[model samples]
Target: MNKDIIYKDLDSLLNTLNLIQEEQTVIKRKLSGLLDHVVPNHFIDWAEEIHQQILNREVALQLLRKDIIALKKTIVQKKSIIYFVNNQYVKLIIKYKEQIAYLENEFKLWAKVTAEKFDTIVA
Candidate 1:
C-alpha cells in the first residue's frame, strides 16, 4: 500500500478506536445506572442482554488495550533514537515495528468481530 494511504488509514483507525472507547465508557455508566434501579421481572431478560453488551464492551476494551500497546511499540521502533543503539538493537527495533504492525492488524480484526457482536446483541 502507498505510505500516504497507510498513514490515512492509521489516522482513521485511531479515531475509530477512540470513539469505541468513549462508547464503551458510556455503556458501562448506563449499565451501572440501570443496575441501581430495580425493574420488574419482565425486564430481567433485557437487563441480562445489557449485561452481555457490557461484557462485549469489556472484550473490545481489552482488544483496544492490545492495539494501544502494539501501536506504542511501533512508534518507539520507528523513531530515530535507535540510531544510537548497537546494530543488533537497531535491527531489533525494526523487527519490533514490523511485528507490532502485524499484531495491531490482528487486534483490529478482533475489534471488527466485537463490533459485529455488539450490533447483534443490540439488535
Candidate 2:
C-alpha cells in the first residue's frame, strides 16, 4: 500500500533485468570474430558477379561492425557516467538525511562552538 515500497520493488525488478553486462559480452564476442564466419571474397576469375556481391557484403559487414563497436564504447562510457552520477546522488542524499537528523535531535552540541551566551550586567 505504500508508494515508496512499491517504487523500491519496481526498482529491484528493473535491476534484475539489466542487459548491459550481457549485451556487452555478446557484442565483444561477435566483434572479435566478425569476419571469421564469412567465406573469403577472393577472386577466382570464374563468377565475377557473385564474388563482387560477396566482397560487397564483406565490406558492409566490416564497416557495420566497426560502427557498432564505436557505438558500444560510447554507450559504455555514458553508462559509467550515469553510474557515477547515481552514486554521487545517493551519497549526497544519505549525507543530507544524516545532517537533518543531527539538527532534529534533542541536543545540538555544534551550536555551542558557533554561538555564545551573553548576560546583562546589573549596575
Candidate 3:
C-alpha cells in the first residue's frame, strides 16, 4: 500500500515535469522566431534570459527524472522507501512549481508584445 502511494506520487511529479518541459519547448521556439524579427534590444535580452532559464530547468528536469527512475528500481527491489518522504524531493517539487509560475507570468508579457508586433506588421 505504501509502495503504491509512492508510485502514484512519482507519476504525478513526472507528469507535471513533462508538462513544464513541453511548455518550455514551445516558449523556446517562440523565442527563436521572435529573435528573427526586428525586436528591441531589451526584448531580445529578456528573451535570452528566459531561454537560459529554460535550459537550466531542462537540466533539473533530467536529473529529477533520473532520480525518479532510481527510486522506482529501489521499490522494485523492496528496498527502503525513505526516498518518498525525502525533504530534497519535496523541496524540488516546490521549487519547480515556483519556477513554472514565474515563467508563466513572464511569458504573458512576451506573448502580448509579440502579438502586438505581429499585428502591426500585418496591418
Candidate 4:
C-alpha cells in the first residue's frame, strides 16, 4: 500500500476514534447517573467496575491515537520507503487495529448485558 494512502487511512481512523471517544464520554456520564440512583448491590458494583474499565479503555485509546498520529508523521517523512512485513510501523498498526476490534466487541457485549440487567431490575 502507498504511504500516502496509509497516512490517509490513519488520519481517518483517528477521526473515527475521536468520535467514538466522545460517544463513550456520553455513555460514561449516563452510566454514572444511573449508578447514582441504584441501590447498593453486587450487580451495581459490577456495573461500576465496568464503568472503570471503560475509563481505562478511553485512556488507552487516547494513547493509541497519539501513537497513530506520530506514526502518520513518520509515514509522511518516509514517503520514499516501502513498508515490508517486518516493519515496526506496520506491526504497530496491526496491533492497534486488533485492539480496536477487540474493544469494540467487548463494548457491544457490555452494553447488551447492562441493558438486560437494568431491564430486569427496572421492570
- lDDT by residue (tens digit), candidate 1, 5-48: 43454455555555655665665565456556746564456667
Candidate 2's TM-score reads: 0.28
Give the per-residue lDDT digits (tens) of candidate 2, residues 8-109: 533443332233223333433432343344334431221244335334534543443354345334434553345434655445434433533443241134
Error of 3 at 13 (Å): 1.0
Whole-structure CA lDDT of model 3:
0.67
Q: Which window of 10 residues has the lowest lDDT sum in candidate 4?
A: 77-86
lDDT of 4: 0.74
Question: Residues 51-108, candidate 3, lDDT per residue (tens digit)?
Answer: 7877787887787777666766666676566764577655654665575566556656
Quality of model 2 by C-alpha lDDT: 0.36
TM-score-superior candidate, 3 or 4: 4
TM-score of 1: 0.44
**Estimated TM-score for each candidate:** 0.44, 0.28, 0.61, 0.75
How does each model score on lDDT?
0.55, 0.36, 0.67, 0.74
Every model: Cα RMSD to truth: 7.8, 30.4, 4.9, 2.7
Among these predictions, the greatest lDDT belongs to: 4
Query: Which 10 consecutive positions of candidate 2 have the poorest summed lDDT?
Result: 114-123
Off by over 4 Å in 4: 41-44, 81-86
Candidate 1 Cα misplacement greater than 4 A, ranges: 1-11, 79-123
